[model samples]
Structures are given as structure tokens and as C-alpha cells.
Target: MTQRFLRVAIALVCLTATTAWNDASSAVAETTLGIGDKAPALDIEHYIHEDNGFGKVEKFEDGKVYIVEFWATWCGPCIQSMPHLVELQNKYRGEGVQIVSISDEDLETVQELMEQEYPGKEETFAEVTNAYTLTVDPDGSTTEDYMRAAGRNGIPASFLVGKTGLIEWIGHPMELDEPLADVLADRWDREAYKEQMKRQEQFQIAMQKVNQLAGSGKFEDALKVVKKVLEDMEGADDPRSNLIREQLTAFQYNLRLDSGDRSEEVMTFFRDQLAEAKKDARELTQFSYNMMASMQQGTDLGPLAGETIAALKDAVGTADEEVMPIMYVLIAQMNASMSNFDEAIANQKKAVETSTGRTKERMEQMLEQFEKMAAEEADGDQDAEGDKAAEKVDAAK
Candidate 1:
């Protein structure tokens, strides 16, 4: 009986090991779409304003020329592509082309986020809401369907679906102006567009997954996804693939700091990153340095303080007039972290003097608050000294 039980236990262990290995292999396996595959279908319940100026719902048509753009409130690239998308929608709406910018964010969250982003512009807000068919699918079934059908891997995935409900073209938004125009004009070959679609579909799935994770505050999980892509890039010869690797690294660094794991090691990590990053890498450098400064949390910035201060000072000398005010405020923040109150005050004062509109008022308020805090610190020092003298007097008595 003991021998029989041992044999059974060994067999179970072998089966479990085989199952774990298969799961691991499946996780990394790529399931990309190719030509002739039926495009995944989704029921996107698009929204528009009602006659009462409240809300109305419309479903996507089955056979129509449409572009469904997956984007988010926080995506910089998505934001950058908005004007072009607006232009495309305006130009194509008359041609039976439907352009819907759908998101996984719910209606209330979308409204609140839009309010913050659009500010006082009701016209622009309403135009965006209507023109792009800004509908939300909280369960993300639409997003999943799109990704699975188009082989999409990221946000800002623009799919040009044909009147036959087939994916004719899919790529980044930048490709829209040319390819979309050709596709709409009936000048683009279906086979060529379908081939390009497959390539982009394979390329974007990891990016889509990363965006999904990051949007949900799953930074660590996003990092893992990006890291896997980076690892897979070792043998790939694509320039855009290389760019994604660098961007993912920079994003992971920023997300790591944001997750409250702001140790000196993270600061050092960014410093090393800045050194290795290309000289033309302005945005990543700025993000890294800014996060590094923030890690100080108002404490004295030690040796690294001079580096941030110098970088800001150099930036100010050549920065465009529009960007100088922002640089000035960052410089002020660095000086404040060093406890150089006088220098901090001077920098903030420069920002206030040079800035216009709401920025100027905000900078002025910050300067005033910092000056008050400095004065209070001085008063507190005086009180401490006086209390020490009083203690000596009482002891003598």
C-alpha cells in the first residue's frame, strides 16, 4: 500500500510540473492576426447629446467606414493626436465615416476628467463629446474585442474599419493623414493595407496591455509588461521597437518613484539613466530630474542639488519664452529643497515676473507663502534661543 501511494504521489507531481510549464509558455506566446481572419466585433454603445441637452445613445453601424480610437485622459500621445483626430472627424463625417474615440473609463469619471482638462471651453468640450463619439465601456469589452481583432497591443490604437466591417488599415494616429486619406479616396490597395494592419497589430498588443495596467494604477505590473518587451527587443532590428524600449524604461522609472518607493537608490538609478540616455532625449531627462528632485521631499538635496540647479539654470538661458516660466518654477523648487531660501525667493519672483495669466498669479501666491514660511522659521529660532536663556536664569535662581 505504501509503495502504491508513493507511485501515485510522484505521478501527481509530474503532472503539476507539466501544467505549470505549459502555462508559462502560453503566457508569452504571441497570437497575432493575419489577412483573411474575421475582424473581432464589438457592441460599442456610443453617446451624444439628447434634444433636451442631456444624453442619448447610438450603436455603431455594422457596415461603415469608421475609425475607433482607443485613448485615455492621461495619455500624452493621445492628447497630442486629438487635434488631428478632430480634423479627420470634421473632414470625414460628411462622407459617412464615423470616428469614435471610446474609452474604458465610465461616464462620471469621463465627465469629471473632461471638466478638468477642457476647463471653460464648452464648445470644445461638446465638440469632442459629439464628434468623436466619446463613449465609455466600464467592462472594457469593446477594448478587448478591438485588441483581439486588430492584434492591437496599446492605447491610441487607430483602426480604419471598412464598410465590409473588415479591418482595412491600423496603425499609429500619425499615419492617419496619409494612409486614411488614400484608403478613403479608394486609392489604397486592400491587400497592402491589410498587410500593414497585421504588422501594427503584432507590434501594439504589449503597448495596449501596458497602457491598461498603468491606467489602473498597476505600475509594477505595467513595468513587468514593458520589461518583457524590452527583453524581447534584443534580437529585433526595428528602430521604432528600440524607441519603445527606451520609452518603457523611462516610464518605469517614473512610475517606480510615484509608487512611494522613493529611496536614494531610485535617484541613483535615474542619474545613471540620464547619463545613458541620448542627448536629444529632452522629455525623459526632464521627467527623471524632476522626479529625482521630488524624492528629496523638501529636505536638503545634498550633492545632487547643484546638478538640478545647474540643469535648470542652463535650460533658462536658451529655453523658449513660453517654457521659461515653467523652468523658473522648477529652479525655485530645487533651491527651496536646498534650504537656500533667498535663492528660492529670487527664482519664484522671476517666474511671477515673467509669467502671464493664471500662471503668474499662481507663482506669486507660491512666492508669498514661501516668504511667510521663511519668516516663521526665523521667529521660531529666536524663540528657541530665548527659552535656552530663560532655563539658565531659572537654574541660577
Candidate 2:
């Protein structure tokens, strides 16, 4: 644990109120499916978008590539990926490619979503999704065969079937371009890809154990689970392996800090992250928030955050407009903690400008408090000066 790592500095899953991974990903109990295997039958109950001319696939139709995506109306990631799926359908529909999105909800739930207007568009959800095949299965029969059988519980999981009725790829829909192109051109190395997905699925299972241990307050044991995986994957340089390794390495610090004991190693890790992420606003914001939150909890991070306050503030310069307001509030709060009321007030004003609605009102209120504190400090300084002058006059007399 003391040795240096790649220091990839992945984002930490936050544990503010308590140091635990609050995972929202859906999970299945068992997996009987794998890449390079035959895709399950398209046991659909109803095609919601059938009336829009987007038909269905009764089974894995031979020679036509299919992207079977599992999603739900309530899953945010699922909803966000809808536009990308539509784009893929447009690009490949004429090329013998079909995109079928399945939801495990009832017809009524999916129909309700169709009635709502699309974001930033006048069309309804049904209209926006008319380009792709949208279906709902109340019985969850298709989900059992695809999602459950694959040991997948996450929404927006896309299963790509190659021309031979075999499942070629399974992953997020947004990342489908490269692999889908490969499958279309017959350039896919199914054997190698299958191994990669297999390893990743195993990694996900290990992560569940790690999360359990961390949530149970057994931080050391939780770290051990990650360490074992890292050790097993020591020489693997594949993107998925590297990403998982990096994520696990960064995740160690969270477990360590939350274990009611702190180490120099953990402190050094964040200190290095603060220094490395100084130029990347999003990364800097995340790192700063993680450190600052711990600081508020009285975790003695050895002034790691205090000493690097200037660099954290520097992120504000490079931050995106949406992120700029958060930087202002973070800086303002840190300044207020050190009793720099004027600086805090300035930042609060910036926050008020960048934000709207309730956020703006809250920032305005914080600005007032800082102004009041600054005025009181100014009056106290003037009284001190007056007393000092009176003492000088008495001495002269």
C-alpha cells in the first residue's frame, strides 16, 4: 500500500454524511450470458413506437446487426442515452442495423412518459424516440433473458448482436460507435473482447464486496478486497483493466480516511491529487470538495487543503460556466472559515450572479452575513485605534 501507483486520479464516489459508496447501479443475482454467445430471443410484450414505423425483431434476425438496449424511464443515464441511440439508428438503419430499446416497466408507465414533452424540443417523448424501436415488457421476460441472464442490473446496457445471431458486444450505448463499426465490418475479435467483458464482470462483482465492507465500517477489509483485484490485474494494460485499477487505487484513500484512522500515505495521495488537478477545473473541483468536506468534519488532513487553497481558487479561472459558481461558493466558505469576511463576501456576490432561483437567494443571504461581519470588524478596529490615541495623550500629560 505504501508503493507508488499510476496515480491516474479517478473521481471518488463521495461519502459525505458517512464514508460509504452510495451506489445506484442495478445488479443481477447471477449471470448465465457472456459475450460471443447467442443473443436471447427478443421476447417483447409490446412495441410502444411500432405505430411510428419502427418495427420489432422477433429473434436475432440473421445477417442484421442488432443493438438490444435495456433501459427504464426512471433511470437518468438511460434517459440521457436515448438521443445517442436515435443517432445510431439513423446512421445504420439502412445498413441492416436495428436498435431495440426495452423497458421492464408496464405499458401504462411507458405511455405516461410518451405524453411528456422532450427537453428543449416541442416533440413528445414518443415523437423523439419514434426513430428507434421502443418497447415495454410488464412480464420482464425479455429482461430475465437479457439483463438477468447476463448478470446485468444496470439500465442503458446495450447488447450488440453481430450478423450471425451471436452477441458481439455489451456495454454502455454512448460507447457503441467503435465496437459497432468493428462488428459491422467483421473486424471484431470476439474471443479477446469476450475475455475483456468477462474480466470486467468479475471486477464488478468484487466491487460489490468492497462496497459492502466499506459500508459496514470495515475499511481495512474493504481496501483488502480492492488490493487483491489490483494485484491480480498487475500486468494488464487494457483500457478497462487500467480504468478499474485506477478507480480502485483512488478509492483506497476514501476507505482509509473513513476508517477512523488517517495515514501519511492517504494524505500524500490527496496532496498529490490537489497539485496534479490544479489545472483541470472539474477534477480540481471534485478534489477540492472531497478535501474541504473532510476538513469540515475535523479530519486533520495536515493542512493539505489549507495550504493548497490558492490552487483550488485557481480552478475558478479555468472552470466551465456551470462549474464556476460552485468554485465561488467553495472559496467563499473556505475564506469564511479563516475569518476572511471581505473575501467571502466578494465570492458570495459572484455566486449570486452566476446562479438563479433559490440558489441565488441563498447566496444573497450569505453575502449579507459576510457584509455584517466585515462592518463589525471595521467598527472594532476603529474603537481600538481611538483607545490607543487616548493612551498616548495620557502618557504625554
Best by TM-score: 2
Off by over 4 Å in 1: 1-29, 32-37, 45-63, 116-124, 148-153, 190-397
lDDT of 2: 0.72
Off by over 4 Å in 2: 1-28, 51-53, 261-268, 271-397
lDDT string for model 2 (10-96, tens) is: 111121111111122244367788887888889888988767555678877788999999887655457657788889999988889
In angstroms, how far off is 220's CA in candidate 2? 2.6
**RMSD in Å for all candidates:** 14.9, 9.8
TM-scores vs. true structure, each candidate: 0.47, 0.66
